[model samples]
Target: MRSVYVFPGQGSQHKGMGAGLFEKFPELVAQADDVLGYSVEELCLRDPDRVLSQTRYTQPALYVVNSLTYLDRTTERGELPAAVAGHSLGEYCALFAAGAFDFATGLRLVAKRGELMSRAPKGAMAAVVNLDEERVREILTGLPFRNVDIANINARTQCILSGEYDELHDPRLRAAYTEAGARFVPLNVSAAFHSRCMTDVQQEFALHLAGFDLAELTLPVVANYTARPYPTKGYADHLAHQISGSVRWYESMSWLIAQGHRDFQEIGPGNVLTKLTAQILKDPLPVETAPAPQPAPAAVRARPRTELVFMYGGQGTQYHQMGRGLYDTDPVFRDAMDRCDAAHRATAGTSLLAAVHDDTRRGRPFDDILTSHAALYSIGYSLTEMLRAAGIHPDAVLGHSLGEYVAATAAGALSFEDGLRLVTRQARLLQERCPDGGMLSVLDSPDLYRSRRDLFGDIALAAVNYDRNFVVSGAGTRLAALQQALDAEGVITVRLPVRHAFHSALLDPIRPDFLALTRDVTVTTPRLPVHSSMLAGRLGTRHGWDEYLWDVIRRPVRFDELMASEFTAPGRHFFVDLSASGSFANFLKHGYAPALRGAPAINQFGNNSGTVRALRDELRRLAGV
Candidate 1:
């Protein structure tokens, strides 16, 4: 049976939506609350005085409720419909169902959207019915006022015009619209929605959306503004542009009907779209006065339970004794590494692998010296290749500071050769800049340091893992000065291993050199999804290889935030940390334990055959191959 699921726009929210569902499905409610960092039930059911009625709260609240309802109802049934569509704010919900945008990104976009749209000037909306579409358009075109335009066309006989309150209240214009065979009814909306009044709001919204890696839709989604289907690459842009454009709802509905889809289900909050469908289908067709009623609604089905395999790498995961092993064992890994080594020499004016294997440091152990940037990149290259051979693909990838270069390689934005070159160059640059200092991971927020600013003078909080977990990096003399000051306040700090202040403004100087090196390189789009620690979102077209390499040096690592968002989805989500040691994997598990429990499983490989075999098995299991 042909059927489509449609979502409603704003003005459909109620006082106690999703309350009953939340009570019945506590797990779903808890999942959503964890993602949003608030009690979903409280936000949906307890806004007694309408404080939640504001656009920011209302849009997200409705979307969460609608999504949960869809999931619940669908789980109790059999299969999704053939098509999905939504009106304005509801379009995100439709995209989620269509697999265009995941739940977390959709919710985030909606929240940001509401906040942006709230900035629009206050205005009014009025529905004009029983009017010809052409004449209504002609009247609106003739209006001499700013911020006034057609908003929604519910049917061939109805349309909504929104604009300034004073302009809408003009007697002559109202009479002109009425004289053209239509009835005008004022609406209760606070601002004119879906009109030029919201032009500024739409512009800001586009910038935020530009950062995400939006994939193609697996199913068709009817566009609101154009009343047509849009390709995946431009979906986000189309949705943002629709904010100030007229919503051709009537045209959209007619287009669907013409496509031979007779069965439609309104899936969120209210049955507004369903009611409109009934009205649109009331008249008999030319062939018959009455056509057979559409088949019963199809049952909804839940997605399969996929295993969450977390892969960790250990210190021994390093190989020195490594380059030859990869060369002999896998051609792909060896070729990639060879190319990387060549790039390293070309960019840094030295052989990176030779530097990594060199044991000439005065006081440091050979392994310690080898584990520097050059060595790390070589190991990262080998590990990623090994995983590919084992058939292990990640749904999401995260890495600790140094390990992030590995994740970038896996995501395809950076080739193994390019990664090694960049890492080698970065390590040399950093070591040269700060030859005698080290970083300390303090378990405190920046606010703590800020509150007692005098006590932590010179020693700045480098990274914020969470409220209580932080990393502070500075020179030894500065650190000593700050430690003496903090000692008086009874606060202690732990020193991290190795050297150099990472993820601090102190690294700013590296930008110019890094940019110069990247200016001559050709960067391409990522083949797989990769989150940016610097941007706290998936890397976009703007972050092609060149920009990413430069940003890696200048920006603060933000993998923690990326991990936080990844764990928000219900059920299993895989995370692979490509490093020589399991250090990054352990850090992630400990740092995000609360969010990790819902994650299905965790795995690690520190240059071991057994771990490699296990990773292969897990990959096969997750991919059902």
Candidate 2:
């Protein structure tokens, strides 16, 4: 049973925060007093000169009390936590607890840190509640917001913004957030402490930081910048960047959850960190006005043994510049994408990276099946790797159409290089031999497609995503006519970006060539359970995988059939949608399955890294982590 000791930062400071701890650790308090050049106990308990709330005094005082509290608790318990973490100013105390530095040295450092941060330029910080990072980013991106950056991502819907005071308080800005169903509350701070506004302060602090040598950590200390364990070297760089960079508290906790840390103890004055920890570990729910719900029977409904299924979506879910953010922000995602790109370029003399990032700066609707097919495989495989790196392993895999190749690779039925080759060859065949057509998404029952012959007589049913959502493929003229007729009937319809009518007669000409290309490929039972789009249930001990693979694209997708069978099963199951646009999760959200829940691996909005962290936390809670 591993655990983490979390320490709160500046905002937790208050009068009498160190009441009993100061007396318990007299020697340490004395050392802190001398190092800080003031009575540590007095500033925390009395604040006689009213400087305790000031940044300089507040930091040192909080550090002393937090360290003392930690020491006292560990001595009484006869042990230390398996790991330690802290928020902003609390990081120094965390490092001290991990044996990275001595008490006096830590006190001296926080004192200097406090002094530098206190001298920062006038700025503002605001806590925006009830809006996710993606939605908040969407709101801010539309406006000309200068110097404003997100300083802290505390939870799924809570974040702190640090920037120029005027920009944060602009009447139109606050009004915009308010209109979009968010509450923005300004924090009492004078400087944009963890933003570019603190660059000058960070540089000066780095000069001071160069004077001391940090010791090797005795235990893991998750970093705020990387949201993972700190490396042995680069203490100065990590610390310097932290001063002027956003605090990824939410991501840090998500990483901890991935590491099998289920218990978190907040060793500080207030319960802010405790509240945040609880929020991060719990499943997010909407506010309801129905009757009160009964308590869960944890013993009867065990989640620790829950099954995890990774579901991958196919085309039309992708947009231009897909995965661009994760590529730039997450090293793990970048490495995985780079590997896939290398394989892609080696085989086809092309780069999925170019498909994802075009010369128009950002791309538009990318419908080139040659590139989109390969891109889908690359993204699906890369996301699986990213999730695995965060300790999320799929008990089974589900792939739709082109995504089946990725699933096959994940399940050990196909080699990564072989999978890439097959995908590119299939894309090429479809481009050369198939008729010009497209896919249309209809928001209606599958039965409607059968009854309305005039509308869908010539089109082929491609996929059934859920009870009321399905896709049809055919020539462009027929798709347009169907979309227009559906729109007139108040039926929601969307034209998918595709070049050919997949799963229809339009693609029959390419089957011979596609089969010939894959004739020499080996197919076997997957190491992990696979529920494919063409199958009614899990692929169990089946042979002729090559034919099955071909049928996966040529046959209509029966995702709803699989969902219908599995969602009603008795086992504890969690679906993790590894789609670029989160389409599968959307289906689960609306389907009338009892207590069915799912988490998406990526988002179309510019927050894939953070979104995946949120997904980890969300799904971890379901697995009883």
Candidate 3:
């Protein structure tokens, strides 16, 4: 079951919207205050200055409050979505979720964005209720209102029109919309957003965006400009364009529901997105008032028992002290790690355990391509063994990116020694042949190719994790430049920590070598059903396993299409993450229905033994064990 967190833009702000959250996340509030040079908590809770209604204050306050609400929710559950999206100002929060930038960076950007926007020429916007976009567009283009634009397509029938005050309030145009079965109500916005009137602001904002550092997206964030995900390469450009581009709220909401996100939580002041989402999906998301902030103990929910779908995590999910406690406390897990280390010692030339858990060489293991992949695979494989030894087994298995080797091995398609050799061999060959390059997880989708045809030098889409979640790979310098451009515009991106770019042209030099090495590796049909990220479907025997292994190196990971197909089938499935971090769990939540969501990672809180016990208890409750 996938869940979506939708944030509202300017129009949704209220006098006392963030009352419950300000006290809950005082640190974040303080950070926001520091960035804005004022007390955001006071503005949100008291609004004594009525500044919350102004565009400059509204944008930053909503952004901070929305971010805190999101942090609070995750603090309660420790899970993020498969993808994230927001309305105009709220997009910054979505970008934050995607790991494009840190919280303080987002606050500063949003504050600046608001300040710039508030300086725009004054205009008026009105909500034209019960009118479709096509009709509204025709009205705007054909008459004295030609200068007017459909600023926001909020729902199937609700369109927000923006232009000069006199034109928007013209008696004839308002009469025309009303006669056409629409209720036109004037809006209190200080200036036109997502309209041509903001052209200068867009350009100025782009200039401001050029200074910020945008990491690639960690989660998929649906961008308002394209009614899809923001691309990894052009973060600031899109946000800049968004100043004069219509907010495709209705289309964005429709696309998510069509992609299988059924549950939604509005993480801001009002239920604007929630209400609009209901209109788009033609079904209401259950609504409730904000609960007073309180201490939330670790929670475990039973019932709705389902078959397990174990997902071995890919790269970018590794961290220091990842499996440290398991190594010390669980003999089964430790033995598997030891065996993997000994087996791959010749090729790796280092201790796998030390690479992952050693405190001394903290950053080296993450930076070295061979070490990182080896650590990810060994930890995942060992965890799988430990889970099985504890009488926990999955009905189906899947892997993201390089995690496929572990999935295949666990499913009996390859032996442990062979899988390790295959992973190590591929890593070594790439390190030998490929120059240092980078992979950036962006928030845009494949539609980015057609919608925004701007060229990103040497960058290719590496993975389409979900509708909005995508990765681009290219040379290190070019990738860095792309990230900077995006960061300036407030588009979020995450630079995947790796020595060389995988699944990009950078890896082409080693393809032949990789294929040749894997040619002699043994292949067998899986003992359990296995899904392929490269194929975007179930692994089939029609092609030799050798071909699949090589294809994994060449093709983009189609995790979005693969998981979509899995959930379209009828039974409940728990997508449990067997990686170092539970980051993939958040991705799964945004892609599948809420019922399919599960833990991000065991021991995410660093209380390894307690977390393991809780996981076992939850599994037993789920399986009726």
Candidate 4:
């Protein structure tokens, strides 16, 4: 179970949002006033002049209140969520939590963003409900409404449109909406947002973003334009494009849900996002209303008989100083690290642990494809041992891509030494032979890309992670060209963090070498159930161990199908991600059936001691210990 903190955007503001928070964080409030050249406390607490309704005043006021609200909550709770997201104006709040910049810097930028938007020509914006994106686009594309563009995708069936004020006021357009059985309500905003109407404003905002320096976010912040978590770099470019891009609220929420975040807390004033989230996720009970005859509060459901499944993550998942806390706090983990270090030194003549445990705490050039694989194998295998020592046993095991080695070792199908040997050989061959390429997580169905293969020259569909999410791998230039084309068509894509384009034709040359490395190691029958992601089925007596090892390099990973099979089985299941960062839990949660929505899926070492404590508390509650 993971928690996501969401912040509301501009339309959620009210006359008295920061009433209590203003006095609680006076220093922050003062700083906000000094930065914006106005009294944020007065605008939020009283709004005596009624000027807070204006876009310029509204953005700064809401930013201050939202920031104060977050500070107040975290101060009292003494913990941070696993990730953060924000609506249009609220994205600044999310970035603040990521530590991309300071409070003053965020306030300064928000003020400018608001000021520029306020200066745009007056335009009309309206919400269209009970209609999907395709239908809305069809309506706006035909006849005199061609200039209208979608401003916000609030939910699967809800969207907002922005266009010239005069064109939107036509009675015929309103009649067309009524005839289509869609409810249309005009918004009070004076300027059109997230549309071509703000092109000039967007250009100016880009200049503002350039002047400020933004550090990489500590926690992932889902972007409104991309509907994916922000990448390791390029914060400035994303924010610049976001000025005139549609606010992908529903998609962003769904992405978070797919990552296994079941608990979401609305951080700012007003329950707009809270109510909207309930609508998007389809919570049966209305979140905004309380009826007089409301039923009793839902009881905490008792845990059913549960089974645990261990999933290992593969390459490109490692980062600087990963497992730092495990090496310090857990002696078992440290001992395993020492053993891996010795093995690595024996083979490579240098200790890989020093690079994995880089004291600089910053990314360097040496954190490349070769070292990343070594660290992943060492840290992942050691963490599994620690879990076994703690009496946490797995009923089954599987791995994604490079994680198969750890999975095989944990399932007793192979020895740790042999697994390390295979990993080392694979890494060396890949580093020495494979050409440079990239992988992009295309946020659409495989059919979407497969149907238009001609458009994606040289790019191959590597893996289908979910119904609408797939990965495309190919040479760097071709992949970049594909990404640009997708962006132009309003399709979201994320560049995966990996050195080589894997699960594609580029790895074919290294297959024979990898097979030779595997032949030297002895194979045995599994002591526990071991699932094969490549086969998208259980590794029954049908396939030989050597065959799966060869297929690991030659075949693509069918993670989507593998999850569907696991989640649909007879008993309650828990997917535990044994990776350095524990980020794979989100993908497991994403593929889970709706019936298993609240199951206890755990991610080891996400926050070191915090994750350990959460796993303990959940297991005890389930066992009734």
Ranking by TM-score: 2, 3, 1, 4
Residue-wise C-alpha lDDT for candidate 3, range 258-360, written one tens digit per residue: 6777798888887877777877788422211221111111122343457687888777777777888888999998999999999789666777877777788
Provide the global lDDT of candidate 1 against the true structure.
0.62
Error of 3 at 239 (Å): 42
TM-score of every prediction relative to native: 0.50, 0.51, 0.51, 0.50
Error of 1 at 165 (Å): 32
Candidate 4 residue spans exceeding 4 A from truth: 1-304, 361-367, 597-606
In candidate 4, list every pair of residues with a backbone clash.
Answer: 259-586
* lDDT for each residue of candidate 2 in 257-331, tens digit (9 for 90 to 100): 766678999998999999999998883322112211121222334434667888887878777778888889878
How does each model score on lDDT? 0.62, 0.79, 0.75, 0.74
Q: Looking at model 1, which ten-residue stretch has the lowest summed lDDT? A: 292-301
Query: Model 2: runs farther than 4 Å from truth?
Result: 1-304, 359-363, 541-543, 592-594
Compose the digit string of candidate 4's lDDT tens values, residues 255-292.
67766567889999889888888877763211112111
> Considering summed lDDT, which 10 consecutive residues are worst modelled in model 2?
286-295
Q: Count the backbone clashes (under 3 Å) in each candidate.
A: 17, 0, 27, 1
- Give the distance in Å from residue 57's predicted Cα in candidate 4 to where it truly belongs: 72
